[model samples]
Target: MKFTKILAAIVTTAALFSTSVASHADALTDRAKSGKPIRIGFAHEIPWAYPGDKNEPLGFANAIAVGVLKSMGYTNIEPVVTDWGGLIPGLQADRFDIITGGMYITGKRCKNVAFAEPMGKFGNAFIVKKGNPLGIHTYKDIKDKDATMVTVAGYVNVDEALKEGVPENKIMQVPSNTEMLAAVRAGRADAGAGTYFDARNLSESAPNEIEPTDPASLPEWTNNWVAIAFKKEDQDFLKAYNAAQAKYLGTPEMLEAVGKFQYTKAQLPGDAKADWICANR
Candidate 1:
């Protein structure tokens, strides 16, 4: 009868484990459907997620997230602003449920967090003096002229530059686009690097101060799409978030919402799977 009791205990334990797993899954779904606000991390990139005049979050990512979540029965969404470099860490630390910055879904980043889906795909553009004094249009151009290329810290452009043979000394990593532009404007760096959309916005915002050159096609870089990042373990949350994203991303409403940002159809990502991007890389 001792053996019989031990077998019964094992069965009971297995049943309890199964119930616990289901409870956690139900909790995640219920918590999301609850009216409680979900926090999303944002950085100060224009047209992505940046603080407005009243320090309120406003940008493409923020708007998209707010719209989708509200329709998903969520009434509140909070934007947790942080530096670009801090986005992933903040999410991992539970400072936010997800990061809504236009962070690219590179293979390197996939190891750290689970990505929902592609939000937008874009190429890189360079910011230079109004008249293109140094003719710095590409990483190769910067390398050829031995000019300094300023990029935001944690941006992929730095890797592209280094791979293109831009010397370490010729690259300055700043904390934000503001600092990169400042370095270029003050003649501290020969040029600034960022996404094409960012370059266009910067040029329009400061017309006389800088001009955005046509995007330079870096051989080592492919067109990368950005996605919302969540902790790797948040499978239930990630799945729900992707469902919400599917309802809005690449839709006509999506275009209208982000139109003011000047993104083009060519820059929009097709329904390509993120897993493919991660695996091929």
Candidate 2:
């Protein structure tokens, strides 16, 4: 009788443990459905995700994320701002429930965080001092001219520069675009590299100081896309988020939400799956 009692107790404990694990796995999705606040982490980058006049998160990625969340009945959202390099770390630490900054989906990142479908695609561009000093038009030119290039830390542009034969010593990784532009203006670097739109935005802001390289001059290898990121373990939440995204992405509503941030129909990611990008990139 004692043996049977012991066996029953073991089975009961096992069942309870299983239930607990299941509950934990579904907690994020459940919280969303219940109208609880879901935290979104974003980096301050122009036209991507940045603070607005009221310090509220605004930009293309932020708008898209908010739209999808609202469509899913997840109305309460809290925005968390951090440096671009800290976004993934913040998500992993439970500082936020998702990352919506115009984060690129790379293979290395795929190993760390789960990505939703891609939302936009773009190529690289360089911001050179007015009059094109150093003749820096492409990543290769930075190396050929033995010039230094600046990019935001943790940005794929850094990798693109290095791949084009620009030595590590010639690459300057700053904490943000503000520092990146400062470095170029201070002559600490010959050029600043970033997404095509990012470079164009900065150059337009300071036409007398810098100008963006011709978009057509950028190589095909420098092209990349952006997506939202989530913790790898939050598969349930990710599934729910993707379902909402499927219904909203590429629709007029999606474009309307992001168009103000300079995102157009051409920027919309069509038939681009995150899994394929992760595997190929």
Report the number of the highest-TM-score candidate.
2
The residue pairs that clash in candidate 1, if any, are none
Cand. 2 TM to true fold: 0.90
Candidate 1 residue-wise lDDT, 1-281, digit = tens? 99999999999999999998878774336556665668878899988888888877778777777767766777666778899999988987888887888888878888998987887777888899899999987888999998989999888888778878999888999999888888889999989998887788878878998999887455535467887787787888778878888877777887787777665566667877789877754
lDDT of 2 by residue, 1-281 (tens): 99999999999999999998867756577667677789999988889999887778799999999999889777788989999999999999989989999998888899999999888887778888999978888888888999999999999987777778899999999998888888988899999988888889999889899889986797775677799999887888888888888899889888988889999988877787899999876
Name the runs in model 1 displaced over 4 angstroms: 1-18, 26-30, 33-35
Q: Candidate 2 regions off by >4 Å? A: 1-24
lDDT of 2: 0.88
The RMSD (Cα, Å) of candidate 2 is 3.8
The local distance difference test score of model 1 is 0.81
Supply candidate 2's per-residue lDDT for 130. Answer: 96
* Candidates' C-alpha lDDT: 0.81, 0.88
Structural similarity to truth (TM-score) of each candidate: 0.87, 0.90
